[model samples]
Target: MDAHPDPSAPAKPSPDPLAVIRSRGYLRILLLAGLIGVPVSIAAYGFLALVDWLQEYLFTELPGVLGFADVPLWWPFPLLALSGLLVGLCIQRLPGTSGHPPSEGFKAGGFPQPRELPGVVLAALATLALGAVLGPEAPLIALGGGLGALAIRLIKKDSPPSAVAVVASAGSFAAVSTLLGSPLLGAFLLMEASGLAGAMLGVGLLPGLLASGIGSLVFVGLDSWTGLGTFSLALPDLPSFSTPTAAMFLWALGIGFACPLLAWGIRALARIVRPYVHAHRLLVTPVLGLAIAGLAVLFAQVTGENTGEVLFSGQSALPSLINDGASWPLGAVGLLILCKALAYGLSLSAFRGGPVFPAMFVGAALGIAASHLPGMALVPAVGVGIGAMCVSMLRLPLTSVLLATVLLSSDAYAVMPLVIVAVVVAHVITGRLPEPPGRRLSGALPSASPSTV
Candidate 1:
């Protein structure tokens, strides 16, 4: 036997996942991520634009054109039914089951395959544009990741899986970089969802960070060029709040305790409804839409508020709800919470969008209602409520805390302590709660990724 190893032999790959950070191939991936961010961001912007236009034309313009003084109480019934029909078709007939079900809660597991993008997009459009109570994040993530992986495959069909995954993640990072109003917030969300930490986390996140930075520029540029606002989350002109009181901490604990129970009930209803919806999607989906519409209509009738308050993802309406918090009656706010939660649960069971905004809306509503309490100022109460509810629903304590504070930028420093306390309490409570019986459907895609690569 030859004592010397052959120079011609291929070397074994290093077991250390972080080794990729030092390789020339990783540099190539970084470059590709940068390049991909442009197209991915543009695509994401276009998708949001289309969703916005469709929503306006169908819900607002079309209603006016049809001679309605305002959108009639029954307006959403047929529109949502149509949405359900389209979404059902996409989920049943197309690939990828119309992306992950919102009922499964937020996650960052696998990206949709390129072939699955059409179904995901169509389903999300139908769900969101037609007034489903879900947001746009999940579909955006799927689109970005799918496009990224597809681009890489087209360039080098034989690319290794690790490289493909990294590029795909970068694509997702770009897609949602501006959706949450900050690239860092989006990064934090994906990072927590990604289950990466320490050295591996750095290696996994750098390409995505680069891509997200570029994506934000593209998003801003597109908004300027097209005169279409970036669909980023923002809550401007919030009432000033500084100094956390002793009473506020007690309020935080109470709100935190309450939020988990509310979240649990919402999720429990969705999970129970999901199996039945999947079993009879064609029939059940449209019915769920009608039910959601009924909830919105009922809320409108009771509160004399616009049905929009309870109909969609609540991203747009949230600011108005908070900015004009004093104008809303306590009874109306409470009713809004009840109706929106039902609509949200129904949407989660059968729709194809995101869970974040609706959850936030509910949290905001809860906070607004709680603001009526003595010794609880509106701003701190809202901050605590939002953080608690978000953590309860998302199980992402850090992201939930940041999300609450980021929206209240001026008051973030004062609110941070309360937000943290609420989030921690909610997260702990949520952890202790047992999973609902048969929470996951058969053949459901797992939501957590074991490896970032």
Candidate 2:
């Protein structure tokens, strides 16, 4: 922190806020965020780890009274019903934890109050533990933001709006930096997702990104030393890609055509499910969850094989989905695609989680389906489908492209070109495609719904 030129200080009237941050008190904000965010992030890690421990302990024990017994699908029904009831009661009772997911996007302006942290953590933990179709990013972000805001309250009594926002943003960035494997990925995600385009983007975003990058490194180093599974978005052997043939280009066109229809369908189901959840929140939510669980069970029992296709988060499933899985029948793969999409949609409607993983899964399934049709290589098809569908759903081409390229190994080199083509095609197609008849308009996760991550 060297003395920076203050554009306004020359006038003897004001100090440039940006320069003030860069110089002045010497980016005490970063120091403040670190002091608070380190503990908050570690706490976030601990909270998730605790949830894992409990699930292993409680969701697996022998069936018995008050033991939270390992209930069959049917049993989770009543138990989940009770859990939903409790959750609903808690939500209604505690609006703090039930506020909203960070996937709703950061405001880039306001800061969360100190009181909001606990509810954010608990709600996310409980919702995730109950096998929601979402990820932990929301809770982690919310906790980080809250902690940073709390620190700002203590350190700089007169911290301006911009200062407070940076702290919160930095905290969030730090919290999930390593979760996604790269700080650049997180930075790009926040930059695009926050809609922080303009002169101000770099001023506010760079510091936050630096914090997240450091935090990600810290998480990686700690996890390596501690041997605790740090949930990271990486696969060592993602498929290799061939050049984009004319057939692959046609596939992109096809995905572009179908992306909106699929996106609309998912949105429609979530909206339909939302009302029922609202009506009998306590009962319907768990019942629907149990129904989803039952579908998972039936898929397993009927298929005589466990694909875990409809299980919790889909982030870790990408590598396996791309690997030696070409053996699945086209019909079966297609059906799984449809079932998982519906499950994901319904899960999105009621459950508290992010839609990114489920959307990615749907894209992968669509790709697998397309590749299985005939001569198309499985790897390229998957990449194209991922880009096309993800862009359509999230309405962001860059993020989808990163997802497509970064999720691969050697293939990303080849995959990058095709992914861009697919994303452009899908973005156009989705925009042109009419909303379903009598269908509601669906925005992206945070923009449209409160629940989605």
Candidate 3:
């Protein structure tokens, strides 16, 4: 009979060469990742452009219009005070508390909601454009994550929560791809921050890589079109580094031990100031701004150098500092370090931005000064100091090593061993150090409803 089928017999499924891909839904998610990356990258470009324009107008053009060809030392005080008030208003009124505290470093926080994006953008614009001593990384990360979530919800209304998280991660990767100057570095930073491991790591990383690759392309294109130059970290002309001598290794150990203590002191000071900042945010934030401005003024008066050296996130200034290391007197470097560190600490307590760049600047300064001492060369000392300080502050050994070495370009290969040693030593010591008492870890806020996204 033609229709004789056994009820108990299992039906055979059709074979397909791409069944693995279809079963895992890899193609769909990857396609979605590519789609997610384009908008996120554009958003990142736009945000950076806005900040650049604002910074120039507020800090440069505004001052020139006020009859000063260059920003006077006293300019930052009033400007930052006003910025503090504006940022304070945002934090007081806006959602997501303007993202997160700078004191927490980088955390594995989930994506912020679309509603929270404005607050973040406003606060960061106020802080950075007005000369706060913090980096753009934290706000960029928040914006990227928020945009990612918002895009997915709009495109696929019924996307699973898991899928949303993956896309969000990819968006963050794409957002930071150009900023870090390497998509690989951005991927590593996100991967390490996410704490993913084993087979799960590969699965999670694939989408991020795809997004980052696309984002990097967008960054290059936009950078070309705008001719603004990619605001990426680069040390295009680093002095040659020699093989590590015993004295240089000794210097590395010393810096490794000392950098964590410096980081701890900064953290401890932030803990001391946190309660005051929270209790009187409007008052304290402005005061903190004034304090940073005051340091910049003091540095200028004492050293006869540009006060701008002591202000802002220290990203653009890093290359200059390294290139002109020989020009600075040892004592001036020390004073700059003290002033910048104090400003960095105050900013951490009251401002809203990332901590990575300032810490790197401080470490690099220390290294440059230490190199002035007999027995150490400048380049190797810089690499070691950056690795140690970054590891101590960020607690990300691999990323720190990459940051220190990668910026050195081919010299990175030669100095890699020293960077590794410093990173390991700093990482271990930082781990052993006791956590600051009475400080609450910055945790991720609850995700907003789909409507909010």
Task: Find the candidate with the highest lDDT and give its number.
Answer: 1
Instruction: Encode model 2's per-residue lDDT on 1-453: one tens digit a residue.
Output: 758777666555444557755774436666765666566567666766765664444444534545644455444344434445555655555544354532222222233456555555566666666555666665666667777767776876788877777887887787777666677776676667667775556667766776776677677666887787776777676555657677777767777678768987877677666656655667776776776666666665655434356655567666677674577777666766776777777666666556666777788888888886555777777877888877877777798888777777678887677778878988888888765333232342123213212
lDDT values, one for every candidate: 0.88, 0.65, 0.82
lDDT by residue (tens digit), candidate 1, 244-332? 88988988899999999999989988989998888889899999999999998898888778889998899889899888865788888
Range of the 10 consecutive residues with the lowest summed lDDT in candidate 2: 444-453
* Ranked candidates, highest lDDT first: 1, 3, 2
* Model 1: number of backbone collisions: 0
Which residue runs does candidate 2 get wrong by more than 4 Å? Answer: 1-21, 34-37, 54-83, 101-111, 434-453
Work out the TM-score per prediction: 0.94, 0.84, 0.92
| Superposed Cα deviation of residue 420, candidate 3 (Å) | 0.8
Worst 10 residues of 3 by lDDT: 444-453
Cα lDDT of model 3 by residue, 1-453, tens digit: 759989789998644535534555667787888888988888888888887788778877888887987777698899889878888888788876786777766664367777888988889889888888888888887888788888889988999887888888888888888787688877887777768776456666788899999999998898889997777778778888757788877878888898999888888877778777788888988888888899999998999987778888888889899889658998899999889888888888877888888888988998898888678888888888888988888888998998888888878888888888888999999999999754563433223332221
Worst 10 residues of 1 by lDDT: 444-453
Q: Judged by lDDT relative to the true structure, which candidate is superior, 1 or 3?
A: 1
Candidate 1 off by > 4 Å: 1-19, 437-439, 444-453
